[model samples]
Target: MDIKAYIESGIIESYVLGLATPQEADELQRLSQTYPEIAAAVAGGEQWLRETADHYALPAPEELKTQLLARLEHEFQPEKQAPDLRYYRRDLFKYAAAVLLLLLTVSGLLNVYLYNNYRNASRDFVRLQSGIDMMAADNKAFQAKLAVLEQDLRFITAPGTIKVPLAGVSGREDYFATLYWNTQTKNVYLTANHLPAPAPGKQYQLWAIVDGKPVSAGLLNPNCTDLCMVTPVQQAQAFAITLEKTGGNPTPTSDQMVVLGKVKA
Candidate 1:
């Protein structure tokens, strides 16, 4: 059988309503088994009938359908309803477009919010990273200072650590100085800051007074703000400094005295 031509005749639709002659029903079954196209045509006809009934958008009253079916069965008649077909496809399209636009708006907003959050997160991460680096640098400096203090503590506990007191003279009201030294270790630490800076071409020389005779140790120009360091010599009793020639004087010229200290260290 030519399936397309058979469908054009509407026999497939008539067969779904159980109105086909006995011979025609048998022919339909045989054609369905012989060609897949015939089976598809039959299915398509049934679906079309259902969709056509639904297109009206309303069901017949239940009692009306029952009564109609009973009359068709009793009279052995073929009946088809011609009901009103009103379409709202345009309205449905408008509703669908509105829903699609709402979805798009929500999606775009979510994307922008997430982008802003990612940018803020990146900024916060960079700030935390910089703070961590600064903390690491501080920790390194603290560790270095700790090591120097450990060395100082060890030397202070050793046998003879002389604590010498160096007092200020003229030009200093009540400012004082001190020196901690270990002659055996030849290490000295000078602490004095209240003394004013010396005039240009003049400086303060440290003298290790031994048996009323003074020996040159080192010089402080008064410009040194940091604690001055001195080399400890053996048999030193006192400390003094006098303004001498720029390189320093081999002997004290007495009148150029800036400061003198009797070492009771």
Candidate 2:
């Protein structure tokens, strides 16, 4: 319905005069609840009527106020009321317990969360520190290796250093050796990895085999895993390894020709 047409009608004036039909009162209640504008208009009209009645106030006498209060007390006086001290105390205890339980649950959750996070953080920190220490150790090891390589290069390149080539032995498929000889200082670096280890109680005697005769230059033991031996060859031509008795034999054992290498001319 168009509220403008309803407002212009004389039903609101008739309702104020207490002459509206029951159907009109119900419709007005519904309109008041449905539309704030209609509610506001009705409230303003009622307020105006109240203000007009106030301006023409025939005030209530003091006797009327006392009589109205007496009538209210007579209408609502209770027949029986219990003293509820214990019951009220029990209710208060229940509410307090509920509040304490809630607080404890919240506190326990927070503590568990904090403990787990603290433990995880501690583990992470330890792992990071360990990684840092391992990196430092690896860096130091690499630096030491670099120093050893530099020293080796310098020692090999020194002046008057003899580089003697020891050729491969015939009939042994992969037998070869080289001697980095430093003749000026009588120091030789034997690269003897291709040679085989001699039998027990029999060592490899390094011989300077010149003109079909074996000269005992020096004896090279078979412990070449960590280091190479440094023995000078005073009169070297062809190299030969012979199996000799314990310590070493003065002459080469003819039957045990384990390795032989001719000197490169």
Candidate 3:
């Protein structure tokens, strides 16, 4: 029932080339009637075979026509008293020309069918290959994303990690964020749990307060929604995030502060 698999199996090619067994041929005929794809595949195969045959077709021998005419004249030679055989000979030639014309007409029709089939098959192959390539690219991307998530999971579950919950400041009560810091390794990671996306040409920057002074940590990547590693700090009394231009400023813009959190003693 898998039409694509069946087409790729080369059974259609075998059937078109007159190489299929009786049972196989019967099955192909039945399937062709039942499925449009199967029918089209069969037509493509037939076209390919015909084109191949034409490409290798041998030219008729030059002496062949002379031999045929001589043999015909001898076979129809008139008796000694009878009139010359010219009239009968003319009729025979006419009949021969008619037969030759019929054969040429049939050959031309076959050529046309084969050419059309070849074009259709080529188009189908291009489309199928494109689809396969796209699927492969998507699969690779998914695997890469899964690997990153797995790494984040391991880091989150490690011991000696402190989780700082950041709450939205002022009117932005709905926004929130989280920061995970590993005290032993001096590593920090941030996640924008419920923060709204920054406006165009702006980004969110993290600041670590040390000895009552704000220290620039790093800028948060706008595209990252999950845990992302940030600048490490050995000590901090508080953490805050503020909106700034694309590249963050040396000092935090206090009015643009979105979320603020303090580290527990």
Candidate 4:
């Protein structure tokens, strides 16, 4: 079996991204135990996802917590009711029976009013609880993202990782990118530093020059805002990128070349 070809087929990526079918994921798990290369590729892909997620992670606004607290305080606040002073009437002895009846009627009406208020308060409390539950869910999600970001930072900063800068070619001098190559594991990661958005239905492709021939590393996602993992190239003399169609071509177009850089010796 061609291990390299299988690794480059993007099954590992799909598995890492949760896009692989259940059967395919099971097969990948079985294969990874038998092949170290597959296992490494899977691990590398996960690290790339974490790193990318970290790069794009946005912190919560500084005033968000204060605003949420203030809103809640205002929403659940109790309303004050003034005391009834009609009970202390001047003609108390003249209409005792009438006053007693009026008092009974008023008591019944107050009970009904209080009951309705309790019901409404219960409903509002439920709605507020649902919102709290949603916010809790969001908080958990953010915590998970923070954990991934930490892991990504540790992975990228590990020893033996080499950074290769790819400068723009002539007439495209402003474009720039960087390649993170793990020499120990032969894993390659790409980060687009500065490049214009691709035209409609167009994309960028990466190439690794090996022995004077260009090999397809992989295609770059134009909307990629963070680190991107490309196909591992163990014996590349240099790396370059060229504009290509949406899905990319088997060979890079020479005239469309945008960036090129050599691997340091």
lDDT of each: 0.76, 0.71, 0.91, 0.87
lDDT of 3 by residue, 96-207 (tens): 9999999999999999999999999999999999999999999999999999988887788888788999999999899899999888888999999998889999999999
User: What is the lDDT for 189 in model 4?
Assistant: 85
Residue 206 lDDT (model 3): 95
Candidate 1: which stretches are off by over 4 Å? 1-101, 170-173, 200-202, 221-227, 243-249
Predicted candidate 1 versus true structure: per-residue lDDT over 1-265, tens digit per residue:
5668887898998898789999999999898889898899899988987897789678658899788878788676335433211236666778999999999999999999999999999999999999999999999999987876776666666667777777766765365566667767877666664555567887767788899999888776455554456666676788766767677888877876666678775
Please report the TM-score between candidate 2 and the true structure.
Answer: 0.52
Top model by lDDT, which number? 3
Each model's backbone clash number: 0, 0, 0, 0
Please provide the root mean square deviation of candidate 1 (C-alpha atoms, Å).
Answer: 14.4
For residues 1-265, could you state the per-residue lDDT of candidate 2 as single tens digits? 8886675585665566567899997898799799887777677667766787889999789799888888897577455545466678889999999999999999999999999999999999999999999999999999997886676566578775555555444566465566655556656566665766666887766777768788876677577642255567665667776668867777888766566766655
Per-candidate TM vs. native? 0.55, 0.52, 0.60, 0.55
Cα lDDT of model 4 by residue, 1-265, tens digit: 8989989999988998999999999999999999999999999999988998899999999999899998898577445433222444534644887888899999999999999999999999999999999999999999998886776565578786778899999999999999887777778888899978899989989999998899998999766677778888787888999999999999888999999999897
Give per-model CA RMSD.
14.4, 17.8, 38.2, 58.6
Clashing pairs in 3: none
C-alpha lDDT of residue 160 in model 2: 57
Candidate 4 lDDT score relative to the true structure? 0.87
Point out where model 4 deviates above 4 Å: 1-100, 112-120, 123-127
